[model samples]
Target: MSLRNITEHTIALKDFQVQGDAIKTHPLSIGASTNRTVNGQQNPVIHIRPGETQLWRLANIGANIYYKLHLPGTRFHVIAQDGVPVGRAYAEDTLLIPAAARFDVLVQGGAPGTTRLETLPYNTGPAGNQFPRADLATVVTSGTPVTRAALPTDLGPYENLSHATIADRKIVVFTENKAGTIFYINGRTYDSSRTDFVSTLGTVEEWTVRNDSDEDHSFHLHTNHFQLMSTNGKAHDPTHGVYDTVNVPKRGAIVVRIHFRDFTGRTVYHCHILNHEDMGMMAVLDIVPPGARPRATHSG
Candidate 1:
C-alpha cells in the first residue's frame, strides 16, 4: 500500500429519508416520514490514480449502517486509523460507519468499473421489528428490510496530522435486554450519561472495546482514529492492516490505540445504529488540554 497518488474527497449525506413508521413507537427512534432527508447527501468519492498512493479522510454523519468502503479492483494501504496518520498498511473491505469515525485509506483506483460503496445491516434484519402501524423498532429481531440501501457518508476537513500517546483507555460496556438489545459504554447509558470517557488533549490513549451483546456493535469515536492492536486477545492483521471503524463480533473485544488532537469539545462515541445510538448506545469524550486542572474520571 502506497500513498504516492491518493487524492482527497468529501462524502456528504443526501438522498435520505426517514425509513419506517414503526420507528415512532420506539422512545428514541427517528419518527416516521413521507420523504425525510435525515443525514446529508453527496458523499465524496475517492479517485485514486492507478498505482497511486493517495490519502482520504472518511467521516460519517448519523447514518446508522455499516459501510463496506472499498475500491474494487484496487487495494488501499491504510495510512491512518480514525484521524491520526499511521506508518503502516491494512487492507479492508467493510469500514464501520460509527457516526463520526474517520479513516485515511490509501488506494490506487481500479479498472473503472463502478466502485460500489455498500452498506449492510450489522445484525440479522429489520423486517419483523416494524409494527402493523408502520412504527420502526430500534431492534430488528426478525430480518432485514429489503428497502434499506447504502448508508450515508459524512466527511469533514482534515487538520494537521495528529499524534499523541495513550493517557487512558476503557471498555464501553453495552448490556441490555429487549426484543433488540441496546448497548452501553462502561455500563452507562447514552444521552442519559452524556459523558463517558474524559481525556487530556494532546495525550494518547488506548481503548479496549468489549462487546458482550448478543448482536454485533460498531464502536465509533468522534475526533480520533485508532490502530488495530488486538482482537479477542490477539494481534490484528497488520498487512491488510489497520482501520478506523472495526466490527466487534458478539462476545469479543477489540483493542484500539488512539491519540486525541485538534478539536476539544463534547465529542461522541456510539453504536452506528442511529436508532440504537439515539436510544442510549452512545457516549461522549472530552479532550481537555494537558497540565490543566483535571476532571474526575469514571471507570465502571
Candidate 2:
C-alpha cells in the first residue's frame, strides 16, 4: 500500500484508471488520490533552523513520470544532475526531473512556516496521461534562526563533447500510430536478436531523439549518461549539467552527445514508461570492442 501511494506522486500514476465518477468514486483502489501523504498519514517533517543550509539529494524511481520539483520561495542551488556532479551550482526555483533522474540541490531553510514539497501537474501531450497534483513531504523549522552556509563560488567548467569529434550520429523516434495498438521505437518492436545501434568502444556519438507521438516519453539509456546539445534547435548550454534520461516532448526533439566506455556488450535504450517498454518500445545498443569488427545493424 505504501509503495502504491508513493508511485501516485510519480509518472507511474498514469497506469491507474479512473473508474465511475472521478469526484466521488475512488480512482485508485489503494486510496492515494485523497491524501497525498503516505498511507493517508502525516508526512515526517524535516527540522532545520531558519536560514540553515541543507543538501538535498532527490531521485525519481517512477517507471514513467516527470516531476517539476518546485520550492516556491526556496531557491535550489543544484550542484549535480543525474549521477554526474556539475562543475558549479545551478540556481533555480523549479527543476524538471524525468523518470529515473537524480538531482543534488543545496537549499537554505528559510523563514519558519509550514511548507510542503509540492509537485504540480504536468501536461505530457494529447495522448499523455494526466498526473494529479500532490505533496511529497512537509518542511518544518526548529524555531531557531541561524546563518546560511557559504555557497560554493565555483566547482569547475562544464564542457560538452564537440560535434566535430562525434564518430557517429543516431536517431531515436517515438512512434504511436493512431491505428496501431502498441508503441514502437524506430518503427520496430524490441527483438533481442536485432541490434538497433552499434558504436565502437571508447568513442563518442551524437543522437537526435524525436517524439512523434501525441504524448511525452522519457528517453533513458543504460550504462551511460549524455550531454544535451540542443532542444528544438536551440543550443542548450552544457554548463547546466549532463543527464541520463530526458523528456522528449510531443512532437519535440533533442540532440545529445554520449560516450561508450569500459564495458562493451548489449545494453538498452527505451522509454521509461513501464507499460510502453513492456509493449515493445525498446531497442538494443551494441558497443563493439576496440579494434573489433562492427556487426551489421538491423535499424535505419
> Model 2: per-residue lDDT, tens digit, 1-300?
111111111111122334455433322232234433322344545565688777777776645556777766798787778878886677888877776777777777788887877678777776766656667667776677866667774668766675448888889998976843578999988888788888888999999999899988888899888888888888876776488888788899989998876779889999886667777889999888888886766543
Residue lDDT tens for model 1, 99-139 = 44566665444333344443433342232122111111111
TM-score of structure candidate 1: 0.57
For candidate 1, the per-residue lDDT at 236 reads 58
Would you list the clashing residue pairs of candidate 2?
11-65
TM-score of 2: 0.83
Predictions in order: lDDT: 0.52, 0.72
Model number with the top TM-score: 2
In model 1, the worst 10-residue window by lDDT is 131-140
TM-scores vs. true structure, each candidate: 0.57, 0.83
